[model samples]
Target chain A: MDKNYNIDEIENFLNQEMSAEDLSSFKERLAQEDGLQEEVDFHATIVEGIKQSAELDFRALVQDTRKAMLQEENTAAKVVDLNQNSKSRVRSLGSSRIVAIAASLALLLVAAWWVFLSPMSPERAFASNFTTPKDVLSAEVASRLEETGFANNQAALQQLQEAMLTYQNDNFEQAQQQLDAFQAQYPNNEFAAQAAYYEALSAINTSDYETAQVKLLDLVDTPNFALQSDAKWYLALNSLHIGNIELAKTLLDSLQSDSKHGTAAQGLLRRLR
Target chain B: METSTIVEQLRTGNQQAIRSLYQISFPECASFIKKNNGTNNDAEDCFQEALVVLYRKVSDSNFQLTSNIKTFLYGITRNLWLNELRKRSKSGLKLVMDEQSDREYILTADDQVEQKQEEEVKHKLIAQAIQRMQGNCKDVLINFYFKKMSLREIAAKMGFTEQYAKKRRYKCMESLKQKVRTEYATLGL
Candidate 1:
């Protein structure tokens, strides 16, 4: 950071108080500048932390109430069960009959579990939870594309579309080639993250899980990668493919609270557990 | 009763409202989890998490439920169970029919995992600091930030002048940031 770098400048950036020209310049600096960007990210973390704290408080309240209710209900149920058991014994429902009934109920529960509920392996869980994002051109991305620059940008967009289509069509090699070409042509393009993601996915499709994992890890480490979470998820899937259970669990656990992937991640985590 | 009333009651920490939620929602949710290889404990835990999610959403003044509360709750519970089912596939559990429609609820497929985790840790640290703070500081900070109240409104609510409220809010936030930074320094996060 420059000696004159004021921490309060981040507040201006965050609060949208910077002039338009300054804002654009700051963003350019943010993209290219290292330490300054880290500072901004650190400050943003505190703001986000404040919000999370409030939400956590609310969640804690709900959980506490639920816990208390469950505890009380359990105690009451235990008393009722005890009374019913003594009453049954007094009514001459012999110990043998009681034991037989208990054994039958246990068998019924086991049979029900085998018939209905069954555990899943982590690999199977991954397969079930992992789905291709239906279209990479999400509504947010589509609207932004309209406002983007032309010429090389337009060509890059076209190449990206082709790569995505080829991947969707299961042409892994062709998709990888198109993505490689796209990245080579526009190494620092705005959509570089998306291209890298598809490249990784293409690698996965071709059963080159190691290459896919590497590509996804690169994206995961890159600052301001637009698809960082998607990269993390694909990386987790890669871990599962390569039998790195601990790494996969770590990635999926981080994603469990994500708005988009929370359910999917939780599903995967449950299996791992 | 109207769903809005139930939501309001929940926000106020009404125990009866919580019971109502459980009574209406838990059975089907438990059944779904059980069929997907989850035990009663798993079902209860999943349902509670779903309720927490719902509570967060409903408590947000900006949120509007497009579906009936029951439908939305069921949707959340079902999504949670399906995810659990996926993880437990080692038990040879198969996807049931209802999962096909769960796709509609996915808002986006992108994430900010590392950054989110960073924030999550800081949140725990910050929450601890807030808990240690005097009640007045906590109230002022919560009102100004979480409740999105203006300084004047906060002042009026707490029976103080706007200037005092503003100063106190700043002081409280600064104290919180200092605590967080100290912990970060110590823990090297």
Candidate 2:
């Protein structure tokens, strides 16, 4: 068995590029040789693996495209809903006079905005950009429980689920407490990073900027944290909430290249500048 | 788009074609799934799996579409959701079967679905191995293999000579094989 066998030979055999005589000879050698079959199988696996990788990438593209289409449909539906609500309200009013008054009020509000609004402040920026992170952990935990039949980490997953449910229900302070307890009890759990992340988000939602900032900093520094980019973005927003404009700017600069947060960060940076 | 054109575009991984497929097929598929006690997420998953199955089928040079693309997709999604429902609850399967009996087409077999799942697991292992490779090696192999780039194109893209690109691809492939070997060994496969 040659250590440096040409990979192309295996590829040619697998692809049926060899002549009939050459393939016959190769098959005979494969039968006679001890390791040649293994080598060929290994090469075939690599080839198939590469093709599968490409197919997986294509599947991802399809999924992403579907998501984008669904998002567009949702946005369009929202616009239609708003239009219908406005139309019903207008019909209920049933008065051209009220409509005129509303139009005048809108112009007056615009004039007031032009006359009295100051430059964007850090607090205003934070308020404009910050949204409470959605409770993703609940669904993840539920799916894991379903897959594993609640056999492993049942207690931990249930606790995480309870905390996520609290967060989802807008019980931020209680969620934070529950998350802290989960972290303390299961510091080395596979989902500990996720718990830490939601804990920080809970603090931020409750206007406890200092606590949130500390937790976000820890998350940003944690290796292999799946939500590191998200932590960085929220940490930047936390800095803005605390009037740490310089820190916010620095963090936002770092996030300027992040795919999910880059455009938002760039927009926020421009406003800050 | 025509059915044949859509299939061709999907075979080539066209995003617009995928979006069109979603717009054309998803609403009816979602309605069917929802009627059968499946959520929007389940509908999405089944639909995506159907698309993958369609892509795989059409990738074969001998594949011929016996039905319209939408019909084909709906059949696959229906079968996939039924398979999922059966897994989730056998009691629900009777009700689903009652509803599904009216459908004229069921494109995929249970064994084929299982095969796809098995292939998915294998592909994921390979993808993980590729991810674990060193950066340059990973990039070269991904470019040459997944991206379907020729050695000359990869060389120009990576700003290396063609000869270097060829050698680099071979070495990276060997590295990937070693990584996959370790993965198989770890799983005792």
Candidate 3:
């Protein structure tokens, strides 16, 4: 083995860029060389390792996406609980009042066909279903630190925690600023997706639908974003909020089979119809 | 989406396709794993591994799907969990597979032994080495090799001359090779 063998020559050979004569000579050398073949194999393994690293990154994305979906499902479950409580409250009403109320409800049902049964306006549907997603960032970060015993990016996590606190406090404007700063400072951090997600939510809460749409669209297009499906669902609502009914329909149609949002999407579709 | 479309989209690294798969397939997979002795975390791990296997297989131009994507993924996940159980010396426990016909899609040569144990070890070492590398070096090497970016494009993207980019890539590769060698020696490989 030549100690002075050029790495470029090896790269060219591996990449199949070598001329036939050079290739033949290189092949013959490769056949006879002791350490050269091992070096080539090592380089090849490094390339494979790099590719595997990218795949692992994608796997992380998939894991985060799953976690986000689970969080959304929990939020939906809370909404369902609220509905159940309302139903139970109705059940607890006195019998005499219930009977009187039932008589009025029967009369109201006839009027409801003429009033509520008409196709709901897109803005109304958006308002009805678009609750702000519950703030789970703090819990998630705490659990992650507990599990790992060390935060890989402690400073970023701290900043995100502060921003999430602002979000939780209903200070949408400041939270959006802090999240934007977090994103700017740590564009490739693991929690950047979460930051982006919260920023979009803030925009929605502030009635900045255009900004919300832009941010949510970026999330929708981002291949590894954890809140991608949530972004899609919210983007649909944002579209409806802005009276882009067709876009809302299209987005909702895509999410019509999403486990967390599917039932809501179907109900909205019915109203839109 | 159709199974074929999912396969194609996965090959392209489309997240929508991945989301679709999770939406349509993962609940059943999770239930099956939990029905057995596995936890939800175990099910997630097996499902991710199965998706990786599927991605690798479909990347090969000669590969063909003989079953639906869901069934194929279920088969792979079941096999993975079974192997894991065997590793834990719990193979005596029977896995509650919902469908017997799913056995037809069990991964054979491709999944069980995708790489020799030695090769897998080497790859892991290399991955560790890459992770420990400096940001610029790692980026240059990955962009050139894994990303298939031309030197000119990389140079433009990184704000350097093409010649410098090529030299930087070579230096990065050398650095990575040295790191891998050190790690390999540390492992007493």
Model 3 agreement with the true structure over A1-273: per-residue lDDT tens digits: 225557778878887999999999999999998788887877677888877765665676566545544543444454356556866897787457768899899768745654565688887888888899889788887666567646567777888889999999999999999999999999998788888889999988987665576677667767777677798899788867755566577667667678988888866876887
Model 1 per-residue lDDT tens digits across residues B104-177: 54423224546657667777787777777766887777666655667898899999999998789767767776
Report fnat in order of the candidates: 0.42, 0.47, 0.42
Instruction: Give candidate 2 regions above 4 Å deviation.
Output: A97-273, B1-15, B28-42, B54-122, B136-161
Estimate, for each residue in A1-273, the C-alpha lDDT of model 1 and write its tens digit.
223355447878987999999899999999997778877876677665665566677666666546544543443354356556766786685557778899899878756655554566767866776666555643434555577566547666766776777877878889888888888988987877778788888877776655576577668667888778788788777767655566677677767777877778876666566
Q: Scoring only the second chain, what is candidate 2's TM-score?
A: 0.62
Off by more than 4 A, model 1: A1-22, A25-36, A75-273, B84-103, B107-119, B150-153
The candidate, 1 or 2, that scores higher on lDDT is: 2
Q: Which candidate is the best by lDDT?
A: 2
Model 2 residue A109 lDDT? 81
Q: List TM-score (chain A only) for every prediction.
A: 0.51, 0.55, 0.55
Pairs in steric clash, model 2: none
Question: Compared with the real two-chain complex, what DockQ does model 1 have?
Answer: 0.16
Better of 1 and 3 by lDDT: 3
Model 1 chain A poorest ten-residue lDDT run: A71-80
